[model samples]
Target: MIDFITGRGLLLLSLRRMYELWVNHSSQIIKQFSILIGLPLEMSNNSDSSLEVFSPAKFPKAMNELSALLEAIAATSIYFKAEIVVSYIKSHSLRIEWIEANPALAKIVTSGLLKTFSLETLFEANRNNKNFLRDVENHISKQLLAG
Candidate 1:
Protein backbone atom coordinates (compact mmCIF):
# COMPACT_ATOMS: atom_id res chain seq x y z
CA MET A 1 0.00 0.00 0.00
CA ILE A 2 2.89 2.33 0.79
CA ASP A 3 4.34 1.72 -2.65
CA PHE A 4 0.95 2.21 -4.28
CA ILE A 5 0.31 5.44 -2.33
CA THR A 6 3.76 6.91 -2.97
CA GLY A 7 3.14 6.11 -6.63
CA ARG A 8 0.60 8.93 -6.58
CA GLY A 9 2.35 12.24 -7.19
CA LEU A 10 0.41 14.42 -4.73
CA LEU A 11 0.64 11.97 -1.84
CA LEU A 12 4.35 11.51 -2.50
CA LEU A 13 4.90 15.24 -2.44
CA SER A 14 3.01 15.54 0.85
CA LEU A 15 5.17 12.85 2.42
CA ARG A 16 8.40 14.58 1.46
CA ARG A 17 7.10 17.93 2.64
CA MET A 18 6.17 16.45 6.03
CA TYR A 19 9.69 15.10 6.52
CA GLU A 20 11.05 18.51 5.61
CA LEU A 21 8.78 20.35 8.04
CA TRP A 22 9.44 18.44 11.29
CA VAL A 23 11.34 21.34 12.76
CA ASN A 24 9.64 24.69 13.23
CA HIS A 25 10.27 27.08 10.40
CA SER A 26 12.14 30.34 10.92
CA SER A 27 10.00 33.51 11.04
CA GLN A 28 11.05 34.67 7.56
CA ILE A 29 10.44 31.22 6.12
CA ILE A 30 7.05 31.04 7.82
CA LYS A 31 6.02 34.44 6.47
CA GLN A 32 7.13 33.56 2.96
CA PHE A 33 5.48 30.13 2.88
CA SER A 34 2.54 30.61 5.23
CA ILE A 35 1.44 33.94 3.82
CA LEU A 36 2.43 33.51 0.20
CA ILE A 37 1.86 29.79 -0.32
CA GLY A 38 -0.85 29.12 2.30
CA LEU A 39 0.93 26.34 4.16
CA PRO A 40 1.56 27.15 7.80
CA LEU A 41 3.26 24.10 9.33
CA GLU A 42 4.98 24.58 12.64
CA MET A 43 6.47 22.20 15.24
CA SER A 44 7.98 23.59 18.41
CA ASN A 45 10.65 21.84 20.48
CA ASN A 46 11.69 23.16 23.87
CA SER A 47 14.78 21.92 25.65
CA ASP A 48 13.74 23.34 29.01
CA SER A 49 10.52 21.36 28.98
CA SER A 50 9.70 18.08 27.26
CA LEU A 51 6.83 19.38 25.20
CA GLU A 52 6.30 19.41 21.44
CA VAL A 53 3.38 20.85 19.56
CA PHE A 54 2.43 20.45 15.93
CA SER A 55 0.43 23.04 14.09
CA PRO A 56 -0.23 22.56 10.40
CA ALA A 57 -2.95 24.37 8.57
CA LYS A 58 -4.14 25.23 5.09
CA PHE A 59 -6.46 27.81 3.56
CA PRO A 60 -10.10 27.59 4.63
CA LYS A 61 -11.18 26.67 1.11
CA ALA A 62 -8.94 23.61 1.06
CA MET A 63 -10.03 20.49 2.96
CA ASN A 64 -7.35 17.80 2.89
CA GLU A 65 -4.27 19.79 3.85
CA LEU A 66 -4.58 19.52 7.62
CA SER A 67 -5.90 15.98 7.41
CA ALA A 68 -2.95 14.89 5.31
CA LEU A 69 -0.48 16.54 7.70
CA LEU A 70 -2.12 14.90 10.70
CA GLU A 71 -2.18 11.56 8.91
CA ALA A 72 1.52 11.94 8.21
CA ILE A 73 2.20 12.57 11.89
CA ALA A 74 0.09 9.56 12.86
CA ALA A 75 1.94 7.42 10.33
CA THR A 76 5.34 8.51 11.58
CA SER A 77 4.31 8.17 15.20
CA ILE A 78 3.17 4.61 14.56
CA TYR A 79 6.28 3.92 12.55
CA PHE A 80 8.57 5.25 15.27
CA LYS A 81 6.62 4.36 18.40
CA ALA A 82 4.81 1.17 17.51
CA GLU A 83 4.55 -0.12 21.06
CA ILE A 84 2.84 2.91 22.54
CA VAL A 85 0.47 3.46 19.63
CA VAL A 86 -0.40 -0.22 19.41
CA SER A 87 -1.23 -0.34 23.10
CA TYR A 88 -3.42 2.71 22.79
CA ILE A 89 -5.15 1.16 19.78
CA LYS A 90 -5.83 -2.02 21.74
CA SER A 91 -7.50 -0.14 24.57
CA HIS A 92 -9.43 1.93 22.06
CA SER A 93 -10.63 -0.40 19.31
CA LEU A 94 -12.24 2.41 17.35
CA ARG A 95 -8.81 3.93 16.85
CA ILE A 96 -7.95 1.19 14.35
CA GLU A 97 -11.10 2.00 12.38
CA TRP A 98 -9.99 5.63 12.30
CA ILE A 99 -6.53 4.66 11.09
CA GLU A 100 -7.94 2.33 8.46
CA ALA A 101 -10.36 5.00 7.26
CA ASN A 102 -7.57 7.28 6.09
CA PRO A 103 -5.97 6.34 2.78
CA ALA A 104 -2.80 8.28 3.59
CA LEU A 105 -2.53 6.36 6.88
CA ALA A 106 -2.97 2.95 5.21
CA LYS A 107 -0.20 3.94 2.83
CA ILE A 108 2.18 5.69 5.21
CA VAL A 109 1.93 3.07 7.96
CA THR A 110 3.60 0.39 5.93
CA SER A 111 6.42 -2.05 6.66
CA GLY A 112 5.91 -3.32 10.21
CA LEU A 113 3.82 -0.30 11.11
CA LEU A 114 0.79 -2.05 9.63
CA LYS A 115 0.84 -4.45 12.57
CA THR A 116 0.57 -1.56 14.95
CA PHE A 117 -2.94 -0.78 13.76
CA SER A 118 -4.20 -4.27 12.95
CA LEU A 119 -7.20 -5.47 14.94
CA GLU A 120 -5.45 -8.79 15.54
CA THR A 121 -2.84 -7.10 17.74
CA LEU A 122 -2.74 -8.89 21.09
CA PHE A 123 -2.87 -6.70 24.15
CA GLU A 124 -2.39 -7.43 27.82
CA ALA A 125 -5.67 -8.49 29.39
CA ASN A 126 -5.70 -6.50 32.56
CA ARG A 127 -7.63 -3.66 34.24
CA ASN A 128 -7.10 -1.58 31.12
CA ASN A 129 -9.51 -3.90 29.29
CA LYS A 130 -12.35 -2.25 31.17
CA ASN A 131 -12.96 0.17 28.37
CA PHE A 132 -11.80 -2.06 25.53
CA LEU A 133 -14.83 -2.62 23.36
CA ARG A 134 -15.21 -6.27 22.46
CA ASP A 135 -16.13 -5.99 18.81
CA VAL A 136 -14.57 -9.27 17.81
CA GLU A 137 -16.85 -12.28 18.12
CA ASN A 138 -15.33 -14.51 20.76
CA HIS A 139 -18.06 -17.18 20.58
CA ILE A 140 -17.47 -20.53 18.91
CA SER A 141 -20.38 -22.50 17.47
CA LYS A 142 -21.15 -26.12 18.43
CA GLN A 143 -20.65 -27.29 14.82
CA LEU A 144 -17.18 -25.82 14.67
CA LEU A 145 -16.29 -27.29 18.03
CA ALA A 146 -17.46 -30.73 16.89
CA GLY A 147 -15.49 -30.45 13.65
Candidate 2:
Protein backbone atom coordinates (compact mmCIF):
# COMPACT_ATOMS: atom_id res chain seq x y z
CA MET A 1 0.00 0.00 0.00
CA ILE A 2 2.83 2.36 0.83
CA ASP A 3 4.53 1.61 -2.48
CA PHE A 4 1.30 2.20 -4.34
CA ILE A 5 0.77 5.54 -2.66
CA THR A 6 4.38 6.56 -3.21
CA GLY A 7 4.30 5.68 -6.88
CA ARG A 8 1.11 7.59 -7.43
CA GLY A 9 2.53 10.54 -5.58
CA LEU A 10 5.57 10.54 -7.82
CA LEU A 11 3.42 10.40 -10.90
CA LEU A 12 1.33 13.31 -9.69
CA LEU A 13 4.47 15.31 -9.01
CA SER A 14 5.72 14.69 -12.52
CA LEU A 15 2.45 15.74 -14.07
CA ARG A 16 2.45 18.91 -11.97
CA ARG A 17 5.99 19.73 -13.09
CA MET A 18 5.06 19.26 -16.72
CA TYR A 19 1.96 21.41 -16.27
CA GLU A 20 4.01 24.19 -14.70
CA LEU A 21 6.51 24.16 -17.55
CA TRP A 22 3.76 24.34 -20.15
CA VAL A 23 2.02 27.22 -18.37
CA ASN A 24 5.27 29.15 -17.91
CA HIS A 25 6.34 28.59 -21.49
CA SER A 26 2.96 29.69 -22.79
CA SER A 27 3.07 32.84 -20.66
CA GLN A 28 6.56 33.67 -21.87
CA ILE A 29 5.57 33.26 -25.49
CA ILE A 30 2.49 35.41 -25.00
CA LYS A 31 4.54 38.07 -23.24
CA GLN A 32 7.07 38.04 -26.08
CA PHE A 33 4.34 38.48 -28.67
CA SER A 34 2.61 41.17 -26.64
CA ILE A 35 5.90 43.08 -26.53
CA LEU A 36 6.52 42.59 -30.22
CA ILE A 37 3.10 43.98 -31.08
CA GLY A 38 3.63 47.00 -28.81
CA LEU A 39 0.48 46.25 -26.88
CA PRO A 40 0.12 46.69 -23.17
CA LEU A 41 -2.13 43.76 -22.35
CA GLU A 42 -4.90 44.35 -19.86
CA MET A 43 -7.59 42.19 -18.32
CA SER A 44 -10.96 42.08 -20.04
CA ASN A 45 -13.98 43.21 -18.10
CA ASN A 46 -16.34 41.11 -20.19
CA SER A 47 -16.74 37.40 -19.59
CA ASP A 48 -16.78 36.39 -23.25
CA SER A 49 -13.46 38.06 -23.95
CA SER A 50 -11.88 37.58 -20.54
CA LEU A 51 -9.49 34.79 -21.43
CA GLU A 52 -8.34 36.44 -24.62
CA VAL A 53 -6.43 39.59 -25.52
CA PHE A 54 -6.75 41.20 -28.88
CA SER A 55 -5.24 43.98 -30.94
CA PRO A 56 -6.06 45.64 -34.27
CA ALA A 57 -4.11 43.10 -36.33
CA LYS A 58 -4.80 39.38 -36.51
CA PHE A 59 -2.75 36.82 -34.63
CA PRO A 60 -1.23 33.71 -36.21
CA LYS A 61 -2.90 30.30 -36.21
CA ALA A 62 -0.18 28.87 -33.98
CA MET A 63 -0.73 31.55 -31.39
CA ASN A 64 -4.44 30.88 -31.22
CA GLU A 65 -3.76 27.15 -31.06
CA LEU A 66 -1.41 27.65 -28.17
CA SER A 67 -4.05 29.66 -26.39
CA ALA A 68 -6.57 26.88 -26.84
CA LEU A 69 -4.05 24.33 -25.61
CA LEU A 70 -3.51 26.33 -22.45
CA GLU A 71 -7.22 26.38 -21.77
CA ALA A 72 -7.55 22.65 -22.23
CA ILE A 73 -4.64 21.98 -19.90
CA ALA A 74 -6.19 24.19 -17.24
CA ALA A 75 -9.52 22.41 -17.43
CA THR A 76 -7.89 19.01 -17.24
CA SER A 77 -5.85 19.94 -14.20
CA ILE A 78 -8.95 21.18 -12.38
CA TYR A 79 -10.80 17.95 -13.02
CA PHE A 80 -7.84 15.84 -11.97
CA LYS A 81 -7.58 17.58 -8.63
CA ALA A 82 -11.28 17.33 -7.98
CA GLU A 83 -11.17 13.63 -8.67
CA ILE A 84 -8.35 13.12 -6.20
CA VAL A 85 -10.25 14.86 -3.45
CA VAL A 86 -13.37 12.88 -4.17
CA SER A 87 -11.37 9.68 -4.19
CA TYR A 88 -9.82 10.43 -0.84
CA ILE A 89 -13.17 11.19 0.68
CA LYS A 90 -14.67 8.00 -0.66
CA SER A 91 -11.77 5.82 0.43
CA HIS A 92 -12.15 6.68 4.03
CA SER A 93 -14.38 4.00 5.53
CA LEU A 94 -15.40 6.26 8.34
CA ARG A 95 -15.31 10.00 8.86
CA ILE A 96 -13.46 9.53 12.10
CA GLU A 97 -10.87 7.37 10.36
CA TRP A 98 -9.97 10.20 8.03
CA ILE A 99 -9.90 12.70 10.85
CA GLU A 100 -7.80 10.49 13.03
CA ALA A 101 -5.37 9.28 10.41
CA ASN A 102 -4.56 12.69 8.94
CA PRO A 103 -6.10 15.49 10.93
CA ALA A 104 -4.59 18.31 8.89
CA LEU A 105 -4.75 16.52 5.57
CA ALA A 106 -8.46 17.07 5.17
CA LYS A 107 -8.17 20.74 5.91
CA ILE A 108 -5.37 21.08 3.42
CA VAL A 109 -7.34 19.24 0.78
CA THR A 110 -10.38 21.38 1.45
CA SER A 111 -8.25 24.51 1.14
CA GLY A 112 -7.18 23.42 -2.31
CA LEU A 113 -10.78 23.66 -3.43
CA LEU A 114 -11.03 27.10 -1.93
CA LYS A 115 -7.91 28.22 -3.70
CA THR A 116 -9.18 26.83 -6.99
CA PHE A 117 -12.33 28.91 -6.71
CA SER A 118 -10.28 31.95 -5.78
CA LEU A 119 -8.23 31.65 -8.93
CA GLU A 120 -11.38 31.15 -10.93
CA THR A 121 -12.69 34.41 -9.58
CA LEU A 122 -9.46 36.16 -10.49
CA PHE A 123 -9.72 34.77 -13.98
CA GLU A 124 -13.28 35.95 -14.38
CA ALA A 125 -12.68 39.34 -12.87
CA ASN A 126 -9.64 40.12 -15.03
CA ARG A 127 -11.53 39.38 -18.29
CA ASN A 128 -8.49 40.31 -20.39
CA ASN A 129 -9.43 38.04 -23.33
CA LYS A 130 -5.98 36.55 -22.97
CA ASN A 131 -7.41 33.21 -21.93
CA PHE A 132 -5.86 33.89 -18.55
CA LEU A 133 -8.72 32.11 -16.82
CA ARG A 134 -8.20 29.04 -18.93
CA ASP A 135 -4.52 29.07 -18.07
CA VAL A 136 -5.29 29.46 -14.36
CA GLU A 137 -7.98 26.81 -14.43
CA ASN A 138 -5.51 24.36 -15.93
CA HIS A 139 -2.86 25.18 -13.36
CA ILE A 140 -5.22 24.86 -10.39
CA SER A 141 -6.63 21.60 -11.63
CA LYS A 142 -3.19 20.01 -11.74
CA GLN A 143 -2.15 21.51 -8.44
CA LEU A 144 -5.27 20.28 -6.66
CA LEU A 145 -4.54 16.78 -7.84
CA ALA A 146 -0.87 16.82 -6.94
CA GLY A 147 -1.29 18.51 -3.60
- Leading candidate by TM-score: 2
Residue 54 deviation, candidate 1, in Å? 25
Q: List the residue pairs that clash in candidate 1.
A: none
Give lDDT tens digits, candidate 2, residues 16-66: 877887787987886776555433444347656543543323333323432
Query: What alpha-carbon RMSD in Å does predicted model 2 have with respect to the real structure?
Result: 18.6
Residue 110 local lDDT, model 2 = 49
Q: How does residue 55 of candidate 2 score in lDDT?
A: 30
Give residue 46's error in model 2 in angstroms: 12
Off by over 4 Å in 2: 1-41, 44-48, 51-105, 109-121, 124-131, 144-147
Query: lDDT for each of the candidates?
Result: 0.35, 0.44
The 10-residue segment with the lowest total lDDT in model 1: 135-144
Query: What does candidate 1's lDDT look like per residue over 1-147, in tens digits?
Result: 133354578788777776566545556675665454443344244542124321212232122332333344442423223323333334532245545554344344342443332232222322234322231212111111222
What does the lDDT read for residue 5 in candidate 2? 41
